[model samples]
Target chain A: MTTKFTPDHEYIRVEGSTGIVGITPYAQEQLGDIVFVELPAVGKALKKGDEAAVVESVKAASEIYAPVTGTIVEVNSLLTNEPGLVNSDPEAAGWMFKIAISDASELDTLLDADGYAELTL
Target chain B: MAEVPTEDLKHTPLYERHVTAGGRIVPFGGYALPVQYPTGIMTEHKWTRDNAGLFDVSHMGPGFLTLNTPSGDAETDHAAIAAIIEPLICGDIAGLKPGQIRYTLLLNESGGALDDLMVARSKTPGTLFIVVNAGTKEGDFARIAAAAGNKATLKRADDNALLALQGPEAVNVMAALVPPAADLGFMQFGEFDWNGTPVTISRSGYTGEDGFEILAPAHMSVALWDELLTDPRVRPIGLGARDSLRLEAGLPLYGHDLDETVSPIEADLGFAVSKRRREAADFPGAQRILAERDGKLSRKRVGLLVEGAPAREGAEILDALGTAIGVVTSGGFAPSLGKAIALGFVSPEHTAIGTKLQVSVRGRSQPAEVVPTPFVPHRYFRKSV
Candidate 1:
């Protein structure tokens, strides 16, 4: 599985044509305690940079955008009850949704592990 | 988010302490203050509820309104000072016993709240210790000074550092640091010496917990802060936790839950209108205020239990039919309750406890219900009579 990241801190881990999405650990740290998470419907299609979800901290609400154009195949309903999972395990169990990649070429435009590391720096 | 120019913001005396403790600094009311420490707001909020939380609140305006010339008699001098300030607010200042504090509102001509403030009668006579919200301090001070004219003086004490130590263990912490403060009843204040420096200690705070608000010299702020943190029960909390704590307490924040256009009655602070002021019909906007009290009011502030996402300020409140009825002024996640809650103003007909309501959050209607507040019960230390 190869992972790609957006400058806005969203990450998409590709396994074949399916990609799992979530915020990076750095983004979760800056957002503080996650109190609520609003996810898109399972069948919703989102373009790159489209607001796909919302994460609310104790202080304010922040929008989470889609990293690449795709159709949402699944969403993490566990986030509704345990939003802190984003803060605790952002990459694995905290994955917000599973998307069916429509254009494989779009993944090439995202930052790779080394590129994302430098962008954060 | 745009970065607020730090150089332009005023720094409190404990600014260095906050930075050294790894606090996340933010601009609040034109002051550079910490929003949260490294431990985060959730932990700090829970700490304050369960133990003692030390907060730096020096940005608030604390001043003394004193009579220029005292009559030498306590009662006469107090009456003289009270008369000057009474015309501006709806509180029975003259009736306050020495060292007693009353929460009151500074009103505009049309009965809207200019600012909410604390006024206390001094034991020394002819002086009233007043504290106003930080954002409205400049205008509030100017207005009070103009009212005093040559008869009294308003000494601004915003330069001093103000600290709040709050929670169930607050009294125990004060008992160890300042023995006399432990005896103070809720809403009472007194002057005490801390390591030879005189400080004012009030047995009150915004958090729904037993606590004390201390006003000390700027130079002694660091030493005092370090001294308090030495106590295992005390933790340094930031403004983020402060806001959350007050919200859970059901207290109104001056700028958000109250403003120049909101009246005391509309803000659910009608209790601040003293009985004597209501009877005399003498305070500013008394006619409108009294009329509102008599059922001429249109909307009322109510607390709500939100079902889904937290309904932040400006979120629209809807009736059962999804018709707009009001707007939320303050809403967020309640750490103690582990659920979303909010304070908002809605038409009087829709404010009854248990009334079903909805909040439109980001174009989605979330289920909500009118509920009684102090979402967490207050644990004030009211001494038995």
Candidate 2:
């Protein structure tokens, strides 16, 4: 599955009407060793670019932004005991939540891998 | 851009190296040191815990105190100088053998700690080498100088640079550079040469591991650091890991764990006070210190393991009923323990191990328990060959 990334480092993988949302590899690298992750509850609705979750490191905490308007369908429950998964595999197994897309057309607004890399650089 | 007061921010010789290594420089103890590398604080902290980490602590004050005499015969009166200096601190300075190092505290007239420092008795009889906190070094020097008053001379070794190589593999990595250093026991120091540069190496470190603190000439620090980095076992660690490592080892940072207002007795640093000094009562704060040592101290420093989120400095410590009882002096998430821990000053009544308490962090009261320090077991090397 192709994953699109946002300028702010959030990534989204569209699967029909649902999307798998997580932070990008670059974001995880920058955030360092993840100690805790606070995922939004299932069924919670979020607007595009709204604060969706929280990821904490040893030294600081950061807010995760929603890439598109959606309702949370699933949250990564493993994060409570093994937040380091976000650092180890931010792109794959470290996916934060799955969302039921409210606006599939909004996916066009996000950046592809190349564009995300350029923005990061 | 308008200029602000940055004169207080001192830079070490390796400041540029830090920037190039992707270190996040921050002002600490009046010096600009790397708080974290590009990997970030958590990564650096975990790396240091699991593997060897190099630290650039060159900004700390490294100096010597020379015993002075009317006839310019320092060796003749070396014992007197060591004895005189001992009164101002709570270490067995007079009993320190040649090439011995001891962690000690500088006390005020009220028995409060002015600063906690490391003093090393060099091979030279009249010279006592010392390393003090960068922020309080000037004041510590002035206090010592004034107290010594012509009995000893305070000489700042500004040409030297300090580096800490810490973690379980630190000894092996450093041993490759200084072969004989591998056998040196903890708290023992000696002069050695690293690639033709004379260096003073101490088998002691803030991290709860077997490590060495190498003090070399400022010009050679960068070269040594680069050379150490070439080894796969050693990775450059920033100040962020250094702080967490020391905190996990239960070591106290100067301004946080100790201050001019907190006495050695109150800080639970009584081990530093020798029995001889206690009996003599000749030190500056001997009278009050002795009283506190005899169970008269009102407050005592203790460690706390907190539940929930991390508790930061200045967090209010509360009783079981949520009443304010004390304040956290230093608190943070301990990476190794995978939990939050804190050091705080509580009433002596609440200082016992396992005493239950609560800490208020971010407007929430979290349960905490009084625990013994070195929150993690210290892994200092004590073997002598």
Instruction: Give the per-residue lDDT of model 2 (tens digit) for B1-385.
Output: 1124545787888888998998867788778887788877766777777778999888788888877763445445557668667867878787777788888888888877888899988877788889888888888888778867878888887557899998888888977999987778998888898888889899888888888999988898899989999998788888777888888888888888789889888888888888777777777688888889889988888999999667778999999998898999888778888998889989888988999999996577989999998999988887653
Q: Give residue A52's lDDT in candidate 1 (0 to 100).
A: 95
Query: Chain B TM-score in candidate 1, rounded to 2 decimals?
Result: 0.99
Question: Could you report the Cα RMSD, in angstroms, for every candidate shown?
Answer: 1.1, 4.5
Best by TM-score: 1
Write candidate 1's Cα lDDT for B151-181 as tens digits. 9999999999999999999999999999999
Point to the candidate with the largest DockQ. Answer: 1
DockQ of 2: 0.23
Task: Give the clashing pairs for model 1.
Answer: none
Candidate 2 docks at the CAPRI level of: acceptable
Best lDDT among the predictions, by candidate number: 1
